[model samples]
Target chain A: MDKTQQSHLLIEDLSVARGERILLGGISLRLSSGQIAEVTGPNGVGKSTLLRAIAGFFPVRSGRMSWVESEAADSAPLAERLHYIGHLDGLKSALTARENLEIGLRFLGRDRRTPLQALDRMELAHVLDLPVGYLSAGQRRRVALARLLIVDRPLWLLDEPLTALDRHACALLKAIVAGHLGSGGLTLAATHEPLGLPGTIQVRLGTR
Target chain B: MTRILLVIFVRDLMLARRIGGGGILGLVFFLSLVTVVPFAIGPDLRLLSRIGPAILWIAALLASLLGLDRLFQADQEDGSLDQMFLSPAPLELIVLVKCMAHWFVTGLPLVMLSPLFGLMLDLDGPALRSVAATLLVGTPTFTLLGAIGAALTVTLRRGGLLLSILVVPLAVPVLIFGVSAAQSATISFLTPFLVLCALGLASIALAPIAAAAALRTAGE
Candidate 1:
C-alpha cells in the first residue's frame, strides 16, 4: 500500500456484544476523506461501543470493518491511521499540561506541531505549566482536545467530546472538528448533544 | 519506536516519583519487614544468620508485590491504556516497557537494600554477597510474573488481594531457585544460578505477550 494514499473506512453489517448482552448489530457505514459522522443516541444505546469497535477496542461479533486505499485492494490497519478519545481523558495527573500533550504527541509517532502551539490553540497557554490534576474539568477537556491537534491522523474516533465543557469550549471543539474536516480528515464522534457541524451524517443507535 | 518507549518509561518513572509513596514506600516497607524479624524470632545471632537469606528473600518478594497492583491500574483508569493499545507500536512492546519501568521503580530498590537487611540479620560477608546476587537476578522474574496478574485484574476495583493470590503461586519457582542459589553459593553455584537465569529469561520472553493478551481481553 502506498503510504500517501488517503484512507476510506468501510463498516459492513458490524455487530458488537458485551458478555451475554448484544449491544448493537447490522451497522454499516462508509466514510471517505473529508467526511464527518456523528453517532447520536440516548444513554446506554451502544454509541460508545460502535466508536470503540471502529477503533479496534471492541471485537466485532459479525461483519467487517476496513480502511482501504482509494484505488487499491490493500488496506491500512485502523490503529495506525486513527486517534481515539474516550470518556476518560488520557492524561497523567502528575504531569503538567504541556508535558502530557508532549508525551501524547511523541507516543502517536507523528511529525506535528509543538505541544505549546497545540495548547495555545486550545486557549490553555496560561495553564501550560500547571499540573493536569490542578486544572478544572473543562480545562482538562481542552487539554485533551489539544491532543487531537498535536498529531496528523486521517481518522479520529471521539466518544463524548463535549461532556464537561462550557458553551464557549463547546464552540471551540466544534471549530476544531470543522478545521479537521476542512483539511481532508475524517471524524466519527459519539455525543448525546448535536455536534453542530454542517453536513454531518448522523448515526442514531437505538437502545437494546 | 524507541522514542515512544522512552517517553512511556520516563512518564511512568515520573508518576512513581510524584504520586503518593512509590519507591520510597517500597523501601520503607522492606526496612520494616527486616526490622520486625528480630523481634518476632527473639534476638539470637546464630538463628538469625541461619535464616537470614530466606527472610531477606521473603521480604524482597513481598516488597516487589507492593507496587504490582498499580502496574496498569493508573493507565487503565485514565484511559491511557486504550490509547496505548491503538498505537502503531505493538501492545507487547508497550507491556514490556511498563514492566521494565515497574521493576526499575520498585524491584531495584529492594535488591540494592538486601545487603543491608542481610547484615542486620547477622549474615557473614559471603552470605550477604550471595543473597544480594540472587536477589538482583531473581527480582525481575517476580516483577514480570506479577505484571500478568496485574493485567488480568486490571478491570477489578479491588485487585490487590487477588493479585497476590494469583502471582504468589506462579512465583514459587523464583523463590525456590533464589533461596537455593544463595544457599549453595559455596558449593556448586553454577547449577542453581543457571536455573534462576533460565527462569528469568523465560519470564522476559513470555510474560509481556501474555500480559498484553490479558489487557486486550480485559477490555473485551
Candidate 2:
C-alpha cells in the first residue's frame, strides 16, 4: 500500500460485521480525488455497508479508515468535507422543494444559489415551491441529488443515487458524476446496473 | 453555533405550533383540568384556596408534556438528528436551545394563563399573583428537567407515556417549590419564590448537558 500518496480515503483490511454475520471481509480500497468508483454487487453483498463504513457511519471491526485532503490527513469533523446521500431522500414532506433545498444547504454550511441551479438543471424549476410530498418519485430523487450541487465537498458517498429515476434523470446524473470527477471530487456510488459513467472502476465485493 | 441552535429551536417550535396543535390544545387541556377540579372537590372556598396552586401547577406540567413528546420526533425521522450530531454545535447547547424553545411556547404561556385559571378557582388576588410569579420562574426548570426524560425516551415508539413516567419523578422538586411558593403567599411568600428561582437557575445550567448526553446515548 502506498501510504504517502495523496488519497482522499484509505481503507486498510476493513471488515464490517453485524453481530456474528460478516458483511464484508478484509476489504481494502483507496479513493483519490478526480476519480469515480462504483460498487456493484448482488443483493445483500454489502455495497451499502461498505459505503457506510467509508463515511464513518460505524466502526470497522478489525481495520482502520482514514480521510485526507490536499496531502494532509484531514481531522475535521464529518460535515466539513463529506456529503453522504443515503437510501432515503432526507426531504421534508411538508416543506416545499425549494425550502427543503435551502434548509439542506444551510445544514451543509452553504448558500441557496447553487441548489437552485441544481434544481433547475434537473428541470425542477416549475415545482420549486411545491411540497415534496406532491412530487413524483423521480422528481424526489432529483431533489435528493440536487444536494450534491449545493455543497462543494470533495467526497461523495451515494447509495443507490439512481433509484426511482427516469431515463432523462439518469442521463443527467451521469453528466453530474462526470462533472464531479472533472472537478477532482471523488465519488463512490452504488448501483446494480451500468451507469455509463466515464472510466469508472467497478469493485464487485461478493466473492470477488 | 448559537445560530444553529436557534435554527433548530425555531424550526421545531414553529412546526409544533402549526402542525401538532400544541399551543391551543395545551391551553385548552389546562383550562378544562383547572375548571373541573372545583366541581370534583366541591366549592369549599377554603379547600380550593389550599389546593388550587398544586392543582394548577400539576395541570400545566401534564399539559406541557403533550407537546414535549413530539419535540424530537420530526428531526429523528428526517435525518436531521444525524446531521445535528455531525454539527460542530455542542450537543448540550442544541438540547438547551430546544428545551428553552419548548418552555417559551408551552410553559411560558401556561404561566401567563395561571392567573386566569386561579380566578376560576376562587383564588385571591395576592395568591393568584403569587401563582403567576412562581410559574413564570419555575416553568423553565420544569421544562429543562422534563427535557432530560424527553431526550431519553425519544427513541421509544410509544414515548409520551414513558416520558411522563421518567419526567414526573424528576419534576417533583419543582412542583413542590412551585406550589409551595404560590401557597405561601397567604403567609410570607418570599421564601418559596426565591427557592423556585434558585431551582430554575440550577436547571438552566445543568439540564442541557444531561439531556444532550441522554439523547446521544438513546440515539446510539
The best candidate by DockQ is 1
| Top model number, lDDT | 1
- For model 1, how does the per-residue alpha-carbon lDDT over A81-149 read when each residue is reduced to its tens digit? 888988889999899998898889888877577888888888889999999999999999899989888
**What is the Å distance of residue B199 in model 1 from its true position?**
0.4
Q: Tens-digit lDDT track for model 2 on B65-90?
A: 87777776666666666656655577
**RMSD vs true structure, all candidates:** 1.9, 3.7
| DockQ values per model | 0.81, 0.33
| Candidate 1 residue lDDT tens string, B48-112 | 88888988889888989988888998899999998897677888888899999988988888888
lDDT of 2 by residue, A56-129 (tens): 55556788777776646546754456777777677777777887777677666645366669799877888888
TM-score against native, each model: 0.97, 0.87
lDDT score for residue B80 of model 2: 61
- Residue ranges of candidate 2 with Cα displaced over 4 Å: A1-7, A15-25, A40-62, A71-75, A112-114, A201-208, B186-190, B218-220
